[model samples]
Target: MKLVEVLHMNGGIGDISYANNSLVQRKAILMTKPIIEQAIRDLYCSLLPKNLCIADLGCSSGANTFLVVSELTKTIEKERKKHGFQSPEFHYLFNDLPSNDFNTIFQSLGEFEHDLRKQFGEGFGPCFFSGVSGSFYTRLFSSKSLHFVHSSYSVHWLSQVPNLIEKNKGNIYMSSTSPPSVIKAYYKQYEKDFSIFLKYRSEELMKGGKMVLTFLGRESEDPSSKEGCYIWELLGIALNELVIEGLIEEEKVDSFNIPNYTASPAEVKYLVDKEGSFTINKLETTRVHWNYASNTNNENIYNNGGYNLSRAIRAVAEPLLVSQFDPKLMDLVFQKYEEIVSDCMSKEKTEFINVTVSMTRNN
Candidate 1:
């Protein structure tokens, strides 16, 4: 799959749309709220600019993007009062790949602004949001134009699939069976792309500008740790079942690998230092469980959890899977995938290591 062309969350508010199925991402957003609020407060307390600019990089299509914008509005209101001045007009930029359902987020702006007005009592500064289309792996804005930047559940994705996965047969992502060379290839790609990301962002941010980033990461140095690889491991098993049943070919499975990687905290700090653009003020991890569907937590909920997980995975992975496997087998593939996921979750806890880092642009 062309990462630029098809790497978007399912669009629209339909049942399968990312707007509906993005609860996991929403959780990540909530976890970062305090960190983001604190950064924005500090920026206003120090810089005290009459006009402020902020960008949400890799902001997929969902209400959570508005949630970030809304909370920032609140933070600006509080900071303005505490600092004895009116808040600056906010220029908000929401960025994602070109294929992202930007319109889903864009369509909600009228409502977002209205709610902000109601909460801020109509005395708020004018806020404008624009959808910018591009990869975050390269420059997206002008030099020294932004004050605070935030990203959630992104930055782990590579610009493209690592080129040396020819030996990573029958696995869609990093698996135990993947050789050391395959892992090396993926990490090397991450190092190059992320270094470029930092260089560009450093140029775009004003002195002392702050950024908050949160995404999937691992606790162990091993990239194939349970936190990083188990999801894909089970997914690989699901695909192999289909292969056994003659639903999909083994060659197709061998050819696909997700353009994403999970790093340990040490790896992350190493990259930050290597890039030489930002100082890591705080790096932390939170464990979130994708257990029984919270909306329905019963014996049956375990089954529901698997279904929800499948849909969530489907929403993101369909583009890649469909591009390779026949569209006719989509339902069957996921049905079997759901069952396997359900059985596995019942046997053990399914969790992710969510990594968050707060950084300051070097002066």
Candidate 2:
């Protein structure tokens, strides 16, 4: 599939939209806030640019999109007040695939700006906002134009599916059944795409500019570990149920693949060193339960976790599923998905491994 055309979070403010189901992503942003704050402070102090240029790559439209904006501005505002320095003018850019819901984000700008001014007061930034539609794998900004860059729950998405995935039949992502060659192909594609991502960002960032990135990754050296792949495995099982019911073609399930990868910390470090553009200041990993209430004593909410998890996954994965399956069958698919996920969660612990790294553009 053409990822640029097919890959995007479900848009708008409806029940199934990403805007409503992105609590998991929001938790990740908050988890990495300390690193982001330090990156912004270091960049601002080093150069003290009057106009601070910031870009949020893979900034899919949602309340989560501006969550990053609030974090950055909050950090800067505190820094300025601490030093008694005048506030800097902020130029913010939000980027995503051209098919993203930029219109929804645009419509909400009035309230967003109003809230920022009211909270930060008169000395607060005159922050300018705009959208750039394109792939981050290619050049998206002028050379040395950006001062601080932030991307969350992105960069794990490959620019395209692996060319050799024909052998990866029966499963949509890396699984225990996948051949050794199929696993290697996934890693190779990630290596190539991530290298280019660093290369382009290095070109766009001013020297000493800082970046904070967070995305899905695996803690185990083994690529097929359940920590990272089980979510998709449960998804694959749901699709197979549809195939058995004759609702979906068996061949379609055999041919379709998710154009995403979860990397290990060792693998990420290897590519960063090989790319030769940035210094890795902090590389840390944290795990988030697929069901946020998994640890709570509330059995009712915990039991309903599967239904909630299904909605969250659907909001993000529906766009890709629709491209290959009948749109009308989506609800049926997730209903099966929720049943399987709820059953699995009751027996085992399931979570997403999030990797957050802070880097500096080397001179």
Candidate 3:
């Protein structure tokens, strides 16, 4: 599959839209807020640019998109007040795949701006917001233009599906049953994609600029550990059941694979060191439950943990699934998936290991 064309979060503010189903990602952002604040403070103190150019890579639409912006601005304003520095202009560039829902993000900017004014008052930055359409794997900004970079719950996505996966039939990701070769292929792809990511970001950021990124990762060295790959294992079981029912072609399941990887902390450190661009500041993992939002006000809407988790996964995975399977069968597919996920949740505390890394460009 052409990942750049097919990969994107489900758009709009509807029931299954990413905007509504992204509480898990929201939690990750909040978890990494202190890291982000420190990065911004360090970057601002080093260069003190009058106009701070920041990029939120893989910035899909919705409240989560704005949440990152709000965090950065508030921290900078507080620092400026404490240090008695002149007010700095803020330039934000929101980037994602070419097919991302730029319209939704643009439509909400007016209210976002008004809120910034009301909250920060005279200390508020005269912030400028623009949408850049393209992949972060490639260069999107001029060299040495960006001052700070922030991405949460992104960057684990590989640029393309890994090769040499014919042995991975009946599975969608690096599941426990996947052959060793299949596991090797996925990690090799991640190493290549992440190295390229570091190289390009290093060029875009000014010397000493800081970055903070959070994404799905595993603490275990084993690539097929349940902490990293069990979610896909359950999804595979759901799809195999559909195949048994003859709702979709068996060959379709065999050929379908997700273009995402969950790297271990060691794997990430190795690539960053090999890339020779950025100095690692902090690397740590935190666990987030699969159905973290079920206890919120929307609890009645979800009613069950299985349904809550299913909607969250569907918001992120539907676009890729629809490209290969019949879009009409999505509701049925996810219903089966909910049953599987819920059943597993009852027996264990299913959680995702999220890795948050803070880094700075080398002088």
Q: Write down the TM-score of every candidate.
A: 0.96, 0.97, 0.97
Name every residue pair that clashes in candidate 1.
none
User: Which regions in candidate 1 have their CA more than 4 angstroms from the true location?
Assistant: 292-294, 297-303
Cα lDDT for residue 244, candidate 3: 98
Task: Give the CA lDDT, 0 to 100, for residue 52 in model 1.
Answer: 91
Q: Write the per-residue lDDT of candidate 3 for residues 45-149, one digit (tens) a residue.
A: 878889999999999999999999999999888888898988899999999998898999999999999998999887666889999998888998999999988
Model 3: residues >4 Å from true position, as ranges? 295-303
* lDDT by residue for model 2 (139-212), tens: 99999999999999989899988877356778888899988888888888999999999999999999999999
Provide backbone clash counts, one per model. Answer: 0, 0, 0
- Report residue 108 deviation for candidate 3 (angstroms): 0.3
Question: Which of 1 and 3 is ahead in TM-score?
Answer: 3
Q: What is the C-alpha lDDT of each candidate?
A: 0.84, 0.90, 0.90
lDDT of 1 by residue, 1-363 (tens): 467897777788886677777778888778877888888888888899888999999888877788888888788898788767886889999999998988778788898788888888856888888889999987899999999999988888889988894579877888778888888999999888888888999999999999998988989888877888887788788888988988788888888788898988898899999989999988998887775223455666665888888888787777777777888887887888889888888899898778899999998
Q: Which model is ahead, 1 or 3, in terms of lDDT?
A: 3
Q: Give the TM-score of candidate 3.
A: 0.97
- Candidate 1 lDDT at 244 equals 90
Clashing residue pairs, backbone N/CA/C < 3 A, model 2:
none
Candidates 1 and 2 compared by TM-score, better number: 2
